[model samples]
Target: MTVAKLAAAPRTAVAPEPTGPVLSCAGLVKRFAQRTAVDGIGFQVDAGEIYGLLGPNGAGKTTTIKMVCGLLDADAGVVTIGGRPLAELSVRALVGYVPQDIALYPDLTARENLAFLGRLYGLRAGLLDERIAEALELTGLSDRDKDRVEAYSGGMKRRLNIAAGLLHHPKLLVLDEPTVGVDPQSRHAILERVQALGDSGMAVVYTTHYMEEADRVCDRVGIIDRGRLIAEGTKRQLVSRLGEKDRIDLVASGDLQALAASMRGVTGVESAAAAADRVHVVAADGRSVLPDLVEAAERSGATLTSVEVSEADLESVFLNLTGTALRE
Candidate 1:
């Protein structure tokens, strides 16, 4: 779908000259007493781009976001929104934030909630009403604007939450796990809305642990872990980091650990690990490496029942880099 047809406004404003990145963060660090939350992270989000921060729980994604929004002070590092430091309140006014948890009043109607938030952003009178209507229509909630938030379905509530964020026409939108706990239909709608926002020239920083969501929605992704960025690239680029390593899954009966060790020493094998009934092997090339894998298994007294060779994917890349599965 075209962005102009989806968004309520034009993609960007006409500038006297091309400016620097829409958003830039460098050496961003956040600490809570003795524990470090965000560890010197850095990245940039250009206009009309959707940058995803992906990691498991407690990877400091939320903490990094909080610091960027000025909801929390950074122990060190710098955050700039539209070339201005985040310490500048004016820059904060230009950002739209959607938190992980629902922040609206449950007893209020969707329209009421949007009006309240719009007023907080200094919108008023006819202009505020017009913006609220535009947001409701954009999020497919125009017909349900008078429904109380608590009476709305999970998906509807999420859509309204997003609409509230857009009411002030912020230049940058930061979404923190916006699709969590929603049904598949709701997730799809949310993603479509996010893509529309990005296409309309609003820079976005999306955080989620869902690999599939990140792969589908983000223009580029930064994979953070334990407060450190371990990988950053497009989905294809990140998967390509596994370079020449084809993954093979073998299910067999025998000493799995011993078989895994033997497979690791194979000529073309790069790494191997055993988990329960399955043995995972990464090889230079699966086609040629299969024969050697079988031989290695036989030598280890494994009665191989099945073997499968799959091309390297993001999951495998995550496993290889972190020594743990992304979903774990």
Candidate 2:
């Protein structure tokens, strides 16, 4: 993938010596009036790593992140950064939080917005200006620095929001669905920027409902479901949990339901579901079952346009653990 052509800037402020993990959470829990939003969850992120939190909407991912950022207090457990507990105000400085929603002033110019936020972090004078410039260049918005935010495209706004988070040169950046509502190009740019951030030595905690994003960027993934952490590991480690199972996705044009049903009894097939013009089939051996699957589709009057087979992925791992599809 081509990285954005960002202007060269000073190296990200060197972080403290890595005496330990960059971010750590242990038995973190949260509760609302009657809902246990996050329950006894724990994980750690090391410097220069991108840790992905994957879950469906309201699976406690947001709540856990809020607690990690100290925006919400956890009812139980502990969150720490660089060996310091989150309760310490000094720790907040080591963390930069990019919320799910746009947090910039739409009426202000991009430069002004970043400058204002930097000032809040005690940045001033030449140092502040340098930080703002670096952030704009990093997000590929330096040319639009003088443009009012309200006049920018959705992708630009999202990129600017991310730039705001880096103005402080944080050690652990927390991004909550930073690409939720944007064009495909914008999402790709954001993901590329995030990967670059990790490559540059900053730890990042990225949360998203998008499975492909997690697969592409995360060094490690934690799957959360119904307020519980179901699994946590690298993609290879998680997929290994699927054992010998294979995942087959077939894009068909007609009678998907009947096609799904037809494939359920295919030799070696374990389960099948059809929705959104695709059929997802799990089998003992995808290669061995491909012919049967194609024959089943043909017998059921479904026209297959595309087919993909893999041993397992983050999506299949999620489904295996939660008993539901990742997007559902």
Candidate 3:
């Protein structure tokens, strides 16, 4: 569901001058009970940029966004938008936050839903109607604007959720796992819209567990885990962090963790970690290490279906840094 963090705030009459990064935050930390949920995570998103917070679930993606949206105060550090502190009520209105869950009214038609939420942000008659039509078209729901939310498919509902987020035309949009369970086609549509938003100069913070999603839609990605940001860069730059290393993927069954452990003992392998259905290994020499890896897998009682070797990629970077897969 959308948090509507900005919906109730008083709107500012003038947009901030775009002279710097549209959103910037640093040294953000948050803790609950005895455990830290977000630890010293920081990044900046300029206008016309899509910055993805790449991480597995509970890696503090949601918690960090909450602080950024001013839904939760940071235990330390600060967040600024367009060079203005988030503590200012007027500045909060400049953020559009679309949460992972759906928040539309089931009985309302798509047009009605937009009209309702649009008014919550102080939109007026003519402008509200125009924004409703625009948001529906932007989300590819203009053809179904008269359809009730209850009758729409899962993907359609997800898209409408995004439309509701755009009514205010905020400078920055924070999307938390926006494509979690949609069909492939709808997911594709959503990604296209996100890319379009970036091209049109909206600073977006997108968070997801899917590595491919991060690779496809994000301009730069920040890999976060265990409440800390481990790495941040573009796809090519992040991959370069693995410098000259080759990655091997062994798709197999049975005791994958043991197989990974066995590979870790091999001379050439730099690292190994087991994930669902496979084990990932990095080495200086990919082809030459295959024989040793096969023997190790056999000794671990694992059955190999296929094996592949390639230069380092985003997956390789994650495996190298965390000793775990992206979906772990």
Tens-digit lDDT track for model 2 on 49-96? 999999989898889999999999999999988998889886787888
Output the better candidate (1/2) by lDDT.
2
Full-model lDDT, candidate 3: 0.88
Which regions of candidate 2 fall more than 4 Å away from where they truly are?
A: 1-18, 252-267, 271-275, 287-307
Per-residue lDDT for 1-328 in model 3, tens only?
A: 0123223333334455545988999999999999999999999999889999988888999999999999999999889999999998778768888989888889999999899887877788987887787778778789999999999999999999998888878889999999989999999989988887877778999999898899999999999999999999999999988888999999999999889999999989988998899999999889999999999989999999999998887888888898888774
Candidate order (lDDT) = 3, 2, 1
Estimate, for each residue in 197-299, the C-alpha lDDT of model 1 and write its tens digit: 8988888999998878888899999988889888888888988888867888899888988888888788977777776687877777899989999999989
TM-scores for every candidate against the unseen true structure: 0.84, 0.87, 0.94
TM-score of 3: 0.94
On lDDT, the candidate that comes out on top is 3
Which wins on TM-score, candidate 2 or candidate 3? Answer: 3
Q: Candidate 1 — which residues are off by over 4 angstroms?
A: 1-18, 248-282, 287-308
Lowest summed lDDT window (length 10), candidate 3:
1-10
lDDT of each: 0.83, 0.87, 0.88
User: Which residue pairs of candidate 2 clash?
Assistant: none
Q: By TM-score, is 1 or 2 better?
A: 2
